[model samples]
Target chain A: MNVDLIDLGNESRNAGSFVSFLDQICARFELDHAAYAGTNPVASAVHGYVNYPDAWKHHYAENGLHRIDPTLLVASRSIAPVDWSRLDHTEGFEKTFRDARDFGITNRGLTIPVRGPYGDIGMLSVTRDCSVTEWEKLSRQILPDLQSVAVHVHDTVMRSDVLSRALRYPALSTREREILQWIAAGKSQQDVGDILGISHRTVEVHLRSGREKLYALTTPQAVGRAIMLGLIYPL
Target chain B: MIIIVDALNKDRFGDLLDEMFKLRARVFGDRLGWEVEITNGREIDQFDRLDPAYVIGLDDEGHVVSCVRALQTTGPHMLSDVFQVLLDGEPPLRSATLWESTRFCVDTQRLCRDGNTMKAVSMATCELMIGSLEYARRSGISDIITVIDPVVNRVLKRSDNAPYDYVGSTKQMGKVPAMAALLDCTEERINRVRAFAGITHDVFANEDTVRDLLDARQLAFAAQLGESSEWMAAILSGSEEALPPVLPEDIQDYCRAQIETAQTEEEHAAALRLVAVLVRERVHPAMHRLVFQS
Candidate 1:
């Protein structure tokens, strides 16, 4: 259960090294599978890394399981670590569980939700094949360690810039940022222009540009996008 | 701050979960008169037994202020189990990426004063909404089936988070007419709620923060004293006048009640020690500061 934080921290800066680290973690914990999926759900961007069987991955993708995977569905609303069996055995879940089992995904599993700053979200899941009684005992024994590991794994992946590459956000210019800041502070275009010693038309142009960059349809939407992107502060 | 508790982290949030269940009892069983199972001041049901994930909001003092429980749609949830009648016998929904959220409530009576409950309710509701969507979006859930009464639906719309669509006709479930409201877990919805609520900062607390908060609460509970008890009133309230020169016999009765409830001898001694310290601290207030500071 002991993780060499120094090694994990140093190796996480590189994508390959991080994947190897995840593999080592899986081995250390006797896990059959380990996965880290960092996604920008807003942009529909996903960057996933896992030591799961390649066939299973292909099957998951080919079937579009990402759209209806109950584990991930529950992971979305969860901040704590989750057990796969804890999910309700409702309608479509049997197929998912069956498919995963067919691909050697064990019945005993845990997924931890990780939230990064500014709309970055990810989950770290570990799966193993064991009886329910054993799974319960082992989970209790390693819960704290697993929690720590999940955070470190998330931190490593975030440091590697994999998600940033997949989910690229447009940066705002200094002028655009300032205008958006004023708008967020409740300044009208005319008021912003007057306060900044610019013309109202110039203010409008900058705001419009900012809005376009943020993919926003209106001023408030632009402000929201900017705030979410850390481009501007809210008043 | 909001804490997401699932099977892995539920152990850490045991006290908070109990608090949330009690709050649910008050809101659903007492206030709304839902025919829910209430035992020992908690409203719990089979869904809770299913190990559903809960997004809980805590105040500065670590009290449960608002909460919502999420169950995977592939399994038994209120919309499919207890309230299937609302669907009018339609085939139950089974999806991997959709979740069911229920037991949404806020501590309105606790948060409000002077008949000004609207603002408190609005703030808590908006915060919970933001927390839920943010969590949902990250977890890869695309849609949420929320089984809500008409009054709760109105609250959502008034808070600027109208459901994207309704799946079933409204039908009586328990005492209120309920329906299945489908909400998309998208950035646009989160933005709309944020703008409506005027909330700009992240509502989530980190694991370390949650651990610390829960640990402090556990210690407070172990002493059989609420964290905001009169024993520490002067120090916490920042008003020396809150404590009298000598302990009142009634206050001593309160301390005695807690001490007498201690299950173990060590716990009894610890509680007694705490009572002695509080009494001594009130008479020599500077001693309390010196002891803690050193």
Candidate 2:
């Protein structure tokens, strides 16, 4: 796997080639499936290729499972690789996994999170169906190599033209942009509303929409993005 | 102040890291004449994409004065990949407790301009050394194998933080000779470096101090841009989480992410504040499940 990673630079040129790379990885490691998902920092859209069964992929997309998939939700937030067995079997996890089992997917898996300097996050998850002890030993042995692979895959994908072209900046409305600018200038929502002669609730609405458009999970993040995108100028 | 920037907090210190990278470009690509890739005034390579921990020193005004890169030896590192020639014929050392320290540099030009050139450079260098060693020691790293030139080697020895041994014989690389030297992450070593620099207080900056400095800088920038003073005053008096209320689930998810990625003591405190907010919002069930389950 380490040797393969050395040549990953030449192989993974686009999403299609990356899928083939994942297939080769699954075959070499004797894993059932290998999946990679990453949030494109510029576009703020999720993009990647997975080697899961077609039906399961379709089901996952139809259900918007990425938002609640424990493998992604939990792992993407972590700096360390997360073992599937350690995840909490919450309602979302139960729904996702129970359906996954129907597709002949094992609940046993490992997800390695890779973070880029630009705040982009990539997750490489691999699952192998086997006895508990065998799974544990295999995961333990391959953890380091898997971590390297995750970084390689993420850097390659980030450099790919496919992702670069997908850099669609979300268009914020005039009001949204104005509110974000005020926020970036250190104005609170109430102050912004009072300055703009709008109700505070209306100010909140615009800020919420601005955050959604920016794909920012927090207001500070939204303000940061707005400033970076030049929608708001702090200086 | 020396700060350790890793995958989790890299976003918070992006500008600082950029300054460090630009310093690397000046030192490695220009000064040292090494064949390093320099793009947009930043010297960043594939290893940097792997999220290596960076021990960076910042002056009172938050300029990157010194920096070093640390990558685990258990995976691909400069010694195993880029500088294999320095390893002779022996296989690269790979161990969970070992890390490779490379790209160690100081902004001698900037430091020298501040005070006595030699004193400033040595102080920043020793501060960075102590910072990396203490950080590595806390993170359970036992040893560090660093690639450095003879000049840095001499400085290390003079500071009493000399490498305990050498990995391979020195070889001429680019304009200078380079060697791989080994250093143990021990209390005595940190103490020696601290003593040499006459640094008694903690080298690592308090998180709140860092945050306040950054905020002040931002506010100053805004003021310089002609932002209304009233708005700046309001921000100054505003609570930390003064943004519009997000959904409970969103808050919970954000808090969970914060908790999972928290590394430093102050980061944990911030995460705890998020948990407290979640509890106050009556979103205890989901937060409770996420917290206790993990």
Query: Which model scores highest in lDDT?
Result: 2
Range of the 10 consecutive residues with the lowest summed lDDT in candidate 1 chain B: B227-236
Q: Which digits, one per residue and each the tens of the lDDT, describe model 1 over residues B116-188?
A: 6678778888999999988876655656779888988999999889987665589876787788887777788
Highest TM-score scorer: 1
> Judged by lDDT against the true structure, how good is candidate 2?
0.73
Give candidate 1 regions above 4 Å deviation.
A1-235, B113-117, B217-294
TM-score of each model, in listed order: 0.49, 0.47
- Residue-level lDDT tens digits of model 1 in A173-217: 566788899888988888998998866645654564465445443
- Which pairs of residues have clashing backbones in candidate 2? none
Error of 2 at A111 (Å): 12
Query: Candidate 1: interface RMSD in Å?
Result: 16.6
Instruction: Give all candidate RMSDs, comma-separated.
Output: 20.4, 25.2
TM-score of 2: 0.47
